[model samples]
Target: MQYYKKDKDKLVCLLCSYYCKLKTNQIGICGVNKNTGDKIECLVYGHISALNIDPIEKKPLYHFLPKSKSLSLGTVGCNFKCPFCQNYGISQEKNIDKSKYYSPKDIVNIALQYNCDSISYTYNEPTIFYPYAKDIAIEAKKHGIKNVYVSNGFESKEVIDDMVGIIDAVNIDLKCFNDKYYKKELGGNLNQVLENLKHFKKNGIWLEITTLIVPTKNDTYEELEKIAKFIKDELDIYTPWHLSSFHPDYKDLDLPRTSLETLKMAKKIGEDNGLKYVYIGNVPYENSTFCPNCNEVIIKRNRFEVLQNSIKNQHCPKCLYKIQGVYPKMKTIRKTGFAGSFYPQEKEEILKYIDEFNKQITINGSFDTRAMIVPHAGYVYSGFTANIAYNICKDKKPKRVIVIGPSHSMYYEGASIALYDEYETPFGNINIDKEYSNNLKDKYNFLSFDDNMHLEHSTETQAPFIKHYFANTQIVEIVYGKMPFEDLSSLIDEVLEDKENLLLISTDLSHFYTQEEANKLDNICLNAIEKKDMSLFDNGCEACGKLGVKALIYSAIKKDMKTKVLHYCTSFNKTKDASKVVGYTSALIGY
Candidate 1:
């Protein structure tokens, strides 16, 4: 009960829910608030824990102007102790013994010099470092740089009330809606976080939310729907809800990685609930916003690099749709693709895989896959199938490639593009012209370059082959999971018309069926794809990305292209097991 005030002899610790009243020399639940000599001065007011220049999207903001650079600042100390704390290393660390200290004056100068539009208080709870954040925010405001706060959103109404004038935008990470999960797992209350979100919105601060979709923990469809519906109803459909992919890090190691499928489901839940802007982060996707009305691609992106932007004066060029965010000048493809596979991940080992895969594909020719159909699963299983597909398409050195795939790895909206300017594939750097991607988003409603797709392997797996063949080219990436076939075809046919635009479909066939049954099931979808018959294909086709396949089929037919299957095999053929098997296929689509 460390609680003390400056007035006479009374003291109160209002740092957390467990408010402890004290006389002198007592502490509160978070252990930082102390009763000291009848005066309550924040002990770690000037202590900054972490700082960096991060993309605004990394904060999981969709509407706060994409690609805006943020000056991120964080300080140690948090009010709650959650079990699945991603930043536990710093949040629970009492490492005041180490690290250099900087004053508020120093921070103001540094933030100004960094050319940041705003200062984001992130990484750890800014509420615990309230005094310092507030001080820096005040100073930053004088320089015309606004303040942005990224928090767990569990602070009191009073704490949120104080941030009113200073914080221009806030990214609130809502852990859960259930009180049991809040109390047992997060060591907080649900009502508190919800109240703060409404408070930020009511107070007229730009608000965003991020929810890490962890495996077997908070990834229920019901929970996702609830969260999405609440945001749509209370915060308005335009409030961007970032569904981030979760890895087994910190203390949550037993949990498997969040499947891209789960992330897709979450996005669907958001859209189903009428959320206008939804995105997936920490996983790769082609999030180029398209006009929800017209299938015209408003924004063209490959990872972080923006390629083709048709958004003019915030209105769609094709459908006259009003756009959002800062629309920068269009970017050109510098060099794209060149992704390698294999990894326990030493840079050298990863590079070697690319080299080997390239060598195998290069024996054929140089027109390699401008776009490819590769497997996203680990190389040991589907490497040969994915490799052969690349080999067949290695003749065309198209400059821009669009790798489309079903999201088995993370949740995302319409399609998400990785924000990385260049993706590496041992072969070389393939520029993902970020400016062009942003322009694409400006022109479309459903498209955006979300950070979530950067490390997504499905599209990345195809890069090595494209790089091995093209070797020195720039490319773009497009990632999507669920949508109508017509929408996919409409978008692809529009952007990928140039022969230089290589289009790839990375998908595995059937999953978890016996080898024989899988082959039988996958062939049905494959036939439909080859015949360019979208209507014949059913959702039960069970192919990971049948939608993308069917969309490609329609696009190919529209162009009168032929479908060439370079390789088709089951997981059983690639492995010793024949029982529980998946399927793989690599096809060269051509005119």
Candidate 2:
């Protein structure tokens, strides 16, 4: 099976929103999906893990048909292994048998017998079984059968375009507004999912949203408000916002279920945020749809059953209020946070960083060069300019690698040695020499833990590209704030003398200054490094990780290293206004 476009030889699987790019034969984040050959085929294609005849309203799509029946089908594998997975048996089951290949024509004919209004590709990520679903959709459409998708909404724009016209309605699960929930619980990017929702709207599809309030996981009042505001502003106020109560399952079995009070509060948040058609699900409550204009019960419902509908030609029967979700303007333009349409600058900046990285390869110190200095902000804010020096640190192969970065979470003090044996990136995981780091920690004052390392990305992000080029590598991560530069450097020198070692120092330049101010001040620091003079650095150099850079500079000078500037960037390039900028640069030091 093949999926994912190549990211510098490492393949990214676009079968699901996780879009995991495998290294060699490794599977995606979903575990079962893989990109092994020429085309990205779902390994479980036609391998229907579960099948059912469900009510159209079970999909919680109130706008389509009040109470229609649909044939719902699902296959194994999901883009994310969410802790509160409702259908973990089929979603997580790894065994694949093609016995479920009921053929596209067969599926369509069966659905027709039951007079199902639609055939839904749902349950365990429809995108994972794209090949089967696409085939089934083609046959179903020929028979005048509609198709629907219940997805996590984390899709690449390219993937969505390929299936544009075939999809009729989609109910995307908007997990949370915060990135931490996405990174920690969902194992995906929140912004990427938000992008898919926008793409659905742009490409023409019926879109509704659902958010399962998993107690503390994503049911906070702040989170609820953010989500409501996002849907109202970004996807449109007329977009139906469904807040479903959650009962613990899967890995979160110990957690308590979300209270009905919480769901009610969340609905209030959505209504207060200007969402016209807010509804609650998964609890015993009124399912009537209220009109934003007259506050009248426009559409009455009982459980997943609709009782009486007051909408006439899609307008409120009483007030004749037309909503913006479809064609009529809803008096509001969606302002979806990062959920909003990507400001092209975000993508351009990342590409700019890659080009600058290639440029870094153009100018260099050499094979024996071992020291480095870099930045640790997002690709938009610092990446374009951060790869200048890191790209030049190519020495064929290194026996070991040491990456030092600053502690940003504020919980840990001084420095901490990573505990995980491997670190990952778009490229792959770099196996860490635990024994080496453990021994080194015994030789220093650093604390070591896996949890702390997981919370930090500065050191982790730098390891992959380095490992990609340099094989037979073992990595060590050091997260420090203010440690003895000379002392740290001395320990590094001792390690290098006995083994082939490479150093990676991550620290952005100025903090929140304008591009002009950052350039003026950061230039002084860059020039000082070019001169190999640590004393030239002023005290006002406001890099959040200044201590890390200062230590690298001191160590590089002590080791008699040479320098080169690879790239530079400021957040002004990422944000609409260039008034405030965060500076980042890539520099190299080698003997």
Candidate 3:
């Protein structure tokens, strides 16, 4: 709210360099923020116009999380009115009341659910939505997720200061070196953008520069060299310069498309000016990342899809020269975050619990099941219920097992798909079905990656059981929060289409209730599952993972699979405290 200043009867917005002064009920030049006589309110705070999961390279971010996915979102309106803006359709359109509202948490959850490495504020100038972007950035930082700004580089110094830690990386547009053109043609200040570029670099935000080379406009050698030299002298030589081609669009429909030769010329100018990495965008040919010192291809790319990255430990494989950008580890392993407490630390202790549970519970016959519902609580509490399913399904021996559960420790909207090479358990390491997981993620917009969400005990507790029962089989863990059961059910149905894939849905019922109350509530869930009656869930079945349970039920009903409850118990069985108890259960769904 302090981003604005009260001047007499008018308020001056300091979010951008324009410094727009507005009367009561007046909006700023961006058309998205309004001065409501008290404070400047972002009209598009929760309104999202465009949202998608795109490759990091499409942000044109060649050096950051290369080959990884990013959750790209933007609202309508912009500070600049460039005629040649390729996305001008949305950027220039200011009436955004019809745009759907997504709270900051929802956006972050979507990013995590999609397995995106970062969240990019793009398609329009992010500075216009500073309040919205700042909120989302704060939430994203909490989960160790990175934030990116695709800006025109004209943010006010105060906003840039706020972005120092929140914004991890940026790709700013240095449209041209001509201040007259910036002011007249683009309705922006070249000096302001240039100053903000230096500010972003000095502030430690990973910086990259892009220039859309409009034919006969900013494609001249002299201007290109000036822009390149400015980057070399002011910014570090390692800063990447992207020379993007301009196509006729929107107001500039009569203008010709930029030739590849002009982009190559700009790239050459950047290199000649001591820039180490210069890429050509909007071209069909491959643009590769090379070692600055050794001049060897460090990362190979076919447009946006990275084919190969040879940087190892942030160094060039050829010369061991230090690289200048963020690099993801070649291999990722999700280690046991809840093993010692949630289950057991030692392999023997875990096996002992399994052995004891097997001895204690006896089911009549083994069933060939495609899906099962298990409780995710400490072994002393719910191991007996969970063991029943693993003991029965071990004979099915599906090639891959997918574990879906609710996020108990965090609030996220969509499902998080674990994208690790391996999942660690007390029994041993379980190989993750990377290929299959990636295929699912690539196919669905709701499925994503969140490293922190995978640490939930609901998903982690099931890993050891899977390893002890189905050794050497691959697994995928999906942790979801605030998601629609219908969507998850569709995904479950798709997985069940494959005869060899087993789905494990984790949940615990009626927490911290009296034993009698717990039993009554737990019975509703049990009856619903036994009858495959999803309608009964609304009648007060208080399963913490009710969404996952509902999804499994929906899938089971659609596949016409029969449901059977193997066991049900309350915490009173172990704690001997009937006053307050938690409920647990195990069930199976198959022919």
- Per-residue lDDT of model 2, residues 528-567, tens digit only: 7788667656544667666666766776666676677666
lDDT, candidate 1, 359-385, per-residue tens: 755343333333355666666677777
TM-score of 1: 0.51
Which candidate achieves the best TM-score against the true structure? Answer: 3
- By lDDT rank, best first, the candidates go 3, 2, 1
Per-residue error for 66 in candidate 1, Å, reads 2.2
| TM-scores, each model vs. reference | 0.51, 0.53, 0.63
Worst 10 residues of 1 by lDDT: 332-341
**TM-score winner between candidates 2 and 3:** 3
Higher-scoring candidate on lDDT, 1 or 3: 3
- The C-alpha RMSD in Å for every predicted model, in order, reads 24.3, 21.9, 14.3
Error of 2 at 85 (Å): 0.6
State the displacement of the C-alpha of residue 8, model 1, in Å, after optimal TM-score superposition: 11
- Give me the candidate number with maximum lDDT: 3
lDDT of 3: 0.89
